[model samples]
Target: MYSDDIAIRVNNLSKCYHIYERPQDRLKQSLYPRFQQLMGRQPSTYFREFWALRDVSFEIKKGETVGIIGRNGSGKSTLLQIICGTLTPTGGTVDTRGRIAALLELGSGFNPEFTGRENVYMNGSILGLSREEMDARFDDIAAFADIGEFIDQPVKTYSSGMYVRLAFAVAVAVEPQIMVVDEALSVGDIRFQNKCLRRLDEIKASGCSILFVSHSSTMIESFCDSVVWLEQGEIRDSGRPNEVVRRYVDYMAHGVNDSGNKSVFDIGIETEQSSNGWEWIRITDQNNVRALDDYAFKRIRVKVGEEPNASRLPCEPTVIEIECEFLALKPIEFPLFAVGIFNELNEPVIHCNSNNLGTRMIPIVDGQLVTCHFKATIPGLRPGKYLLAIGMDEGLLGAHQLLCHVYDAWVFQVLSPRSGRIQGGYVQVQDATINLQIMKGDRQ
Candidate 1:
């Protein structure tokens, strides 16, 4: 028996494949096994057993989104395929309720010879949609895909992005009770990806469960209600997205090291890889002299604590200190310094500058090394990795000449708060005080 509230349940699920040394070995195993069985003898094994997943178990509640993360061969895809019923599990049982729409491999159910229009109908039928139902939704699906006239053309002529566009369009149009997505969305353009994300948000809001798999920590932490971390085909950890993702990242960066005891940021004076080691991959280029504009970032250093830059709790009072040196090739005046802290998605979550703070800097002469320091308190940012960027410009805020700028200048981590979990959003308001005034009133 299965509960109505449980969208998916897997118990002791395992999948194994036979690894043959050669083509002849596969043939021999198929023939010899049957011959041994017929002769009343034990079958001789001719292949090695490779267990892709072993004793994996979990539950996805109705309307809850879960994220699965692991290394390349950590069996993420295998697990998803089993849950989607495309691959049979060698052992254990999987029970799922309601209609399932999945975007597995790129063009998995698509036929190269069939037109995009034809494949959409075929996929819809596979998802338990009637011909009439698909007919009603076909125009909307075609418009969402935005492939234009290519919808009538063969699927083989479409690019990888186009295939995903059409497939995602069809999948979402089904309005399934459960949505399973692999990393196929990564192939689409930013606009299409955003569109898909918006659609997914709508699905989730409608009480549909989602199983998302991605290598991006930012996406998983921001999108998932819960996360499952798999290691070597087994469940390593499962719980809140922030905690699980932090552990996973720590292990990936420094395996077997006591992550709890060690700090992620090391601000030593002369360490092998100091904060100053970050190279400035300039984003802007110009053939004119303005691009060459006599200014260059020489070095940068960030300090979060006296010991080292370690994980911080939410709502913790954090003072970010930045020291940077620059070489001014020309005379610079009223230099404005900006420090930006970006999240994993490269979105600026925190931006502070001297101009905003009303701190005016003195003028600088050519061939001079200008050193500046910046200090600011970071609000209650959600637990995740953050990157630091620095920018220097001469003149006023509205109109200024770019002197130098470098992104990913430094890195830091924010751990979950001990008192409570600050869920969702980029930054939380610090030290908030609530004053409730109760007034007598009558219900009208």
Candidate 2:
């Protein structure tokens, strides 16, 4: 039994569909199962079972807002449909308390032949409201939809935006205790979207539980109290919004597997000792090295505020140290040392090169090791994992020959305390200041 405070309880909820290779296979499967059963033989199957959701379970407390995030075909929509009672589950059950309303796919819960005003009444009736009650709320619904005279036109004549507006209006007008929204707000204009968000905020304030499915991490982080990440019809992770969203972003950007063991950006490096006169290696034998014949990265290390993994503040001073060595038959001059920081998306966030900074490495002999250190205050980085790439090159800007380079040599995480200001986008602008100024008009 679920506690009284729980708004929704999903227990091992699963949905499966039979996928037949051909249309005839479906009929064959249906008839063969019964025929085999009658013959006292094992049931024959002509179709494969496709599970859209498998053994998913979670609970949402009353008045809580939860966000669902996942890639395409991840069963986010299927789960929402099952929770809203529009689709039946193949296994397990979902128990929900209080009235539930959903804004699902575009034009859902709306009839094309019915006018917008008429459809509102129809949807209201489905939500357990009387015609008299709907009439009392009709003006408020129309005003919220803001479709004006278009409310008199058939839904078939409405655009996607208008359809969403009317659907959202009806869903919220019933004053549901539980609300499910699946990317419907994304179709409206920016202004209308803000208005809808404000309305959702008011609803949330009124102790309504909400299930929001959106692709934008910013939206999830901003509005959701908790988050669930789904992949391949299974729950990948579920927890606080910041933590789950960060992991989801990392998985999406770096292709991190569900097991969290394989990293797409990880490359094998060679670091074995050699008796040859010139050998390329990593500074630490423990680190894997992918070395080139002429150049190699010896080691890479990062430190934030004297701590290895405690980068709690965005404005903290961070240090990156790279040790490299080159084996040359003759003397080499003006080698360039560079280090770049990339976010989970593999996009460069910070790049620094000795040549660009007017600092050149000393002339090198046959087997000399060079160490480069970089120190800077990291601009506010969104709370997520990042990578460091290091390289050595031969000339100045625009005409440099890459001797050797290692991508994603080191991985690090930024841990910023949760705050509304730090939730969106990749970078947190530290020391940002804003001022408003006014100039007096000359004309009267």
The candidate maximizing TM-score is 2
> Which stretches of candidate 1 lie above 4 Å from their native place?
37-40, 256-444
- Cα lDDT tens digits, model 2, 156-245, are 999999999989988888999999999999999998888888999999999999999999887888899988898889998887775576
- Candidate 1 has a TM-score of 0.64
Which candidate has the top score in lDDT?
Answer: 1
Q: Which ten residues in a row have the lowest lDDT in candidate 1?
A: 282-291
Per-candidate local distance difference test: 0.79, 0.77
TM-score of 2: 0.70
Pairs that collide, model 1: none
Tens-digit lDDT string for candidate 1 (238-327):
877765775676467424222232222332222235565432222221101122457877666566644333334345667766677778
